[model samples]
Target: MKRLRLYFALFFILLAVPIVILLSHTYSNLEQESFFLYRRTAESLMATVYQRLQENLLVEEQRPYTHYRYIHVADRAVPQQEGLNLSPLADFPVQSKIPGILGYFQIDPDGSFHSPLLPDKDPAIAVPQREERQEMKDKLATLLEGLFSLTPGLQAQLDELKLEESPPTAKKNSSNFRDNLESRVDITLEQRYEREASESTYRLGSKEDPKTDSLQRRVQKSSLRQAEIFDSQLKDAYSQDLEKAKESAAPQRADDAPDSRVVAGQTNRAFQMGDELRSQDKDVLSEPEAEPEVVAEVDPFQSEVIDNRWLVFYRKVWPQQRRYIQGFAASLPEFLESHLDAAFLNSALPETASYLVFHQGELLEPTPAGQNNPRPLLLHSAALPYPLNDFDLAITVAQLPQSPAHQLVTFLALFLSVLFLGGFLGVYRLTVKQMELAQKKSDFVSAVSHELKTPLTAIRMYGEVLMEGWVEEEKKEGYYQQIHDESVRLSRLIQNVLTLAELERSEWQINLTTVQPVEFVAQITERLSNQVKRAGFEFETVSEGEVKPIQVDTDALTQILINLIDNAIKFSKDAETKKIVLTASQLGNDCYIRVRDFGPGIPSRKLKSIFEKFYRIDNEMTRTTRGTGIGLSLVKMLADAMGAHVDVANRQPGTEFSLRF
Candidate 1:
């Protein structure tokens, strides 16, 4: 049993040790593989966003770039023209090549700066002058007679409507809307031209008289103020024309009935509808739905969007036609959504996944769910580089194939645990059985050797005494009888051993015969009475239950009883009142034979192991009785071959060994 246990321990150790190591390595590789994939995704995503963002920035901002170089246009100071007091004109090749440089100016010997684009004017920022006020007024009259019209589309549409196209030819006639718009625009320009003529009259008067400097200054100031007022008036007239056109095209029910002779009214209305459609601006620019809340305080360098005002850019050194540097004051949320929302929505991620982008301290996220979702368990993030280096984006994901490495590692660990455990249990059972068989075989060899030698030594000793004639004639017969008895004992011991060997090999069989129980017991007791008395053990044969005839193999039954009686005598030899009983009875269809003894009882724990081959009760020390351990073992084998069941129990004073056949 101990050897069997050791085999089991060894098998389990073999099965488990290697599997643990294999799983450890598998998990390590899984982690490395997962990390590699994550890093790979992050690196490629950053690179792609970097390239795209750089392009967007350059295309949108059109930033100023500068380069410096020392250009010597001349090796020596050039002589100035003695007659010319004005500065050199702006015709520099270098200035044209440089970005945003409007023009160049050089200081003349008279300390006056000049550029070709800014050539001399009589008075700066003043309107052009005309001498013939009457002739100009006549040209205006020619223009008003229809030489030109700025609002061609509105005028044509209003002509088809025939609602109010012009002022009436008669006092009672309805007005014409087209004529009214034209007169208003033309009259404003004519009025400004009239003011220009008046200013020119003052300049002409000042030029004729050399000492009218004061009068010239006053005239220039008055002309400048009048010019500003005229510009305002012209702008207002144009705006009014635009507003009138829009109002006329607004959706409303026509006042004139279709059949009431309304100047082919349907066709005219259709043409006007087409005109209105063609006049609308096609470029659709988005505006914020709601204005951003105003703060109590303002921050410098951070401006808000303004209505109807554009942030325009112009050449750096231009003639003040536009501002040099200006930023488009955009509503942050609306602008970003218009540009970036669709891109993220149509990306490789699933519809359920979320994408969030934060740039320049502002955040943009898609709301496909109509509301923002909570942060999910799995998320991948990457930072943008170059133009968008301060920006980052994250994707909250749900379907990532089980985190590739995590799935692999978990599967491997589960598979290995089951495989190793099954292997350990299977191999352990086989190994344990093998070990038990080997242990029993070794004990059998030692026991057989001891038993065979015991009877042979005694038989040879008495025979030699008779051969040597070492005894008187009176004792010679006793010696001869002793030799015969010893010979019989040796023969029976050899027969039992051979029978047990044949039984183990499955080569032994029994032939049963019907015999009277009383006769059966008497025949067996007659043979074993003298032999047991010589060993100082009293023996008896008894019957129980119904004394019916029993099926018995005569010779095998005799051997079976011999072994059982012998085992009882051997174990009970040291008892205070040594005795053995062989019992035979018929109960139902089976025969019961019991061999009982009055001796020290068997221990409860060792009872089951007593019938095993080469097993004995006196396992701790050699016994005083002369016997091998195979006596009871042979009895058990013979009983089983005869289709009998053997059982044992602790008797009141000793032990009970019984068989049911």
Candidate 2:
């Protein structure tokens, strides 16, 4: 039984091992799958957000990029702010929320624009930019050597204007002006005739200001008029001088002109052939450098994110229907809340999931789980969705909280483990009980055989002596008495065995009758007194009150007392003064008979189990009492069949047995 319990315990533990592993495996898989699903949902949501941003930006598609592109420097007293604001991109609709935007700037067709964002900038930074821009222009001039033929005539044109405008003197002033033109960086023509108040006189005088210098204002106004005339004359004279120079310098045949120099412009009138530039650069080519190729129309409504953070877009605000490139810069976070967040708020995704975006090596907004944790997983990464700003971008989402049903499954798995342990314990206990009973039954058989043999041998010996006439009459009486006592004891053992067998097979019958308690006590004492006296135990009987007649079975009642007395005698062998008491009493409607012995009492732990069939108080391996284990069992079975209850209890230096009717 012990070994079986151990095996069962080990089995259950082994069983739990795989279950725990399975549950853990299942949970890990679910977590991974959930992370995958969240990744997909985040992708869908980001796509929608980007789409909405594009749509919102489209509202200003046709409205021209005039507001984003102007770069005017303050000259004299007035700050010329034609279009450029200090924070030029601050006014763009989608980009307005961001604080860091360099202005929209375009380099001349042959150079690169690398201007920084404008506000009040430090001179140290501006100086570097100026130097870099100058380098870029110099590099561009080298690459477009054929285009230099158009540039050389401009400095000469400015020198001729100052010469023609001066009195037939001031030749040194004209020479200084030509030297300054050569030093100037930007060479684009600015039409002074197109200024807002062109061809107009000054209007500074008012009637209320009677002392104002009207003559002084008139002189200033006349100076401005003369300047405007000078600008107009410069434009017309430069065109004529350029044509005359080309006509005089060129050979008669187109092939005869210097190959290193080509008059670069939109039309072939400046150069006979236009093959110096690559085909891809044609869209950007325009007057003064290269010819403009016919370009396919692009949707002006298009807009896109730049380098994962900036916004690159365009506006066709150029006058005379000329094409140009324009853009704006913005903070990515501000843009998300202002435009993208609403789109995501309306997307269909699990509420337990949250998201973060990472581009290149930088984490944009939201964030990964923590500093120590990478995004749970990765696969669905979307790059910036426009050709203009090609950025490597990705979003990682975490699905953190588990569902209620998932929690329930985990609970059930643990509960099942406990149940398995409980069941193993219960089964082990029952097996132990069975084994104990089996051992007790084997001990009972051996004890019963020993008891029967002792008496049977004595009877056989006395009968043989009497039959052989081996003793005189005086000794014969003692031998016959010994033989008779042995017979009687052997008969009692046989009768008890037969009775127990009958009870076990459900064949025992009860003849119940109304019997007085006094009579019942006398009947039990008469049957047990001889055996008690023979065992050298002091026996006594007592009854309380004039007992009423109680339902009783005389034969079964005698058997119960006889077995109790016999068991007491067997166990009380070591007592100094062996004593047995048979008491009868009446209380309420029941009569009680108690047979007690003064001897070592039954163990308190085993007291309740003392009456089990084939069960003995003596240890099975070292039983010394001369009786089968069934005597008390018979007592209990007969008493139960006769409408009575039997009980046993431990007492000081003794054990007590009782039957109630």
Candidate 3:
């Protein structure tokens, strides 16, 4: 029972060794496969993120307002009204909010815009100032109104003239009146009259003050005439300015010249309208041209929308956005509150609470949340951080299943582990069984040798006594023959038992020496010829090649030859003329020895196991041979010890045993 337990323990250990090795190798391969799977998943996620952002930006770019609404407000002169305020527009709902917009402001009294969010004392507010030249033009027109109001009647007459029909002639007439009025208007009134009868007499004393009265009347008439001319000239000048402003304010037309041209008819009509206003005693500044107010330019690099709420602004945002994305990628949260699928999050985050974020093909760090650290939020550039802007959009990638290669590797590892364990267990059990059988065979051989030795000794002693003339002379002949035959049989049995013992112990030794191949064959034939003839067999010896000395054990060779010749003699039952042939040949550095006999050949299936101990064909001829089965087994063991090989094969009519040394 203890031996059995030991054997079982050894078997399990032997089985476990290879199983452990296989399992370790399998596990390593699985880890590598898993790593590759992770890398592939990361790469795919990055690609998805990049693609989604790009698509969103493209869709956003296609909108009409995106191209038109990128206004830059640089200076802020008033703190209360700056940034992107839409509250001042009464038509806009008070509760309405715009994403990404910071604040708004109107141009201040100091000709600058200011943000209400920023302090009034901020120094960036005081930059280069714009002069507001349009406002100045309005104030100038108000100052000139009284001076131009006097020409109401003349202005009516000028308005009746078709300025658009002949603008050059009207301009010339108006210019002449301007020159005359500039020369005549004065703060002090003086009259100069042409005198006709002055030569007759010196002036009489006491002339009335005609110059004051007549000068006042003439001044009033001149002022009215000059005002009409001034009005017409001012109207023409204002119309020209209006045309220039309209041209400047007009959106760029497809085929318009680099320098835009104004239509002459339009300019003339504008002037005529101004002239009509002058006839009503009103000062008319050129009408401000109507312009389509452009708010901002669409950001082309922005991404498109995936779902309606998400705005993906891929690479289109500012350089700061690039930095933000890089940082965000470096710190992905294990958990996220996004509208993305829950399964995606669960699969992506490992049980160890590890999650990876990738952006644009790069891996990122995760943002940690704790007692002091709040979660860092990612926002679009168009939308400022929370409390500054709002958005209902998010971005995330779905986790994919394990790849086929990974699964295959895992399965292969498991399969190999099982195979290795099973094979080890089988080998271990077989080895133990073989060892136990060998031990039992050894013990049996020891007991059999003891039993056989005593009886054989007693028989040989009695037969020798009879042969030494202790019986009658006629009886002595038969006794001597019987003694010789009995002694031979006993010696064979003893030799077989000893050979078996030596083979079992693996202690069979060979002393190699060089001997002539022909001499060796001759000696063995001469010694075994009598036995063969007695057994009714014809013996032949064949030799080839020069009589060269070959390296071999003479004693072992003698035993091998004796066994083959004896077996051939005993087993050659089918031949009418029983014959045994011993042949020797040399090829290169090796020698070949063959023993052939015209005998009933070994059966095909038994041939393989014929060299095993006690193994023999179960047939009538073999049972009558009276032979122990150790002969061929000894032959094989001796051949192996001598570094030579022996084999048997069926000849055409019999059997052959061949040895290569």
Candidate 2, residues 192-298, lDDT tens digits: the string is: 22232222212111112222112121101112222222122223433443343355443434334222113111112211111222234666545555323222122
Q: Worst lDDT window (10 residues) for model 2?
A: 213-222
lDDT of 1 by residue, 474-583 (tens): 99888877887878878887887788778889888778998887778888888778888888988788888787776767777778778777877777888887888888
| Decreasing TM-score order of the candidates | 2, 1, 3
Residue runs of model 3 more than 4 Å from their true location after superposition: 1-256, 259-426, 432-436, 439-478, 499-509, 573-577, 619-624
> What's the TM for model 1?
0.46
**Root-mean-square deviation of Cα positions for candidate 1 versus the true structure, in angstroms:** 27.0
Q: List the residue pairs that clash in candidate 2.
A: 102-117, 306-310
Local distance difference test, per candidate?
0.48, 0.52, 0.45
lDDT, residue 266, model 2: 12
Q: Residue 598 deviation, candidate 3, in Å?
A: 1.6
Q: Give the residue spans of candidate 1 off by over 4 A.
A: 1-379, 383-453, 460-481, 515-519, 547-552, 585-590, 619-623
RMSD of each: 27.0, 23.3, 31.1
| Residues 1-661, model 3: lDDT tens digits | 4786687788778867886787677665554454344434433433343333334333433322211111111122123322211112111111112222212222121222222212122121111111222233233233323322322234334334322222111001122332322232220111111121222111211122232112110101112222222223223345443454355443433244121012223323333454455568755558844322322211222122222222322211111111000000000122122211232343442322222222222222332211111221111101111111122111211222345765776687678767866786787668767775575456446545654675577677767677575788777766665566567757766786787688678766778999888888998889877667767788899987864677898988888888877778767855765989999998887788999998778889888987876555553233555455667877888888788899999988889999898
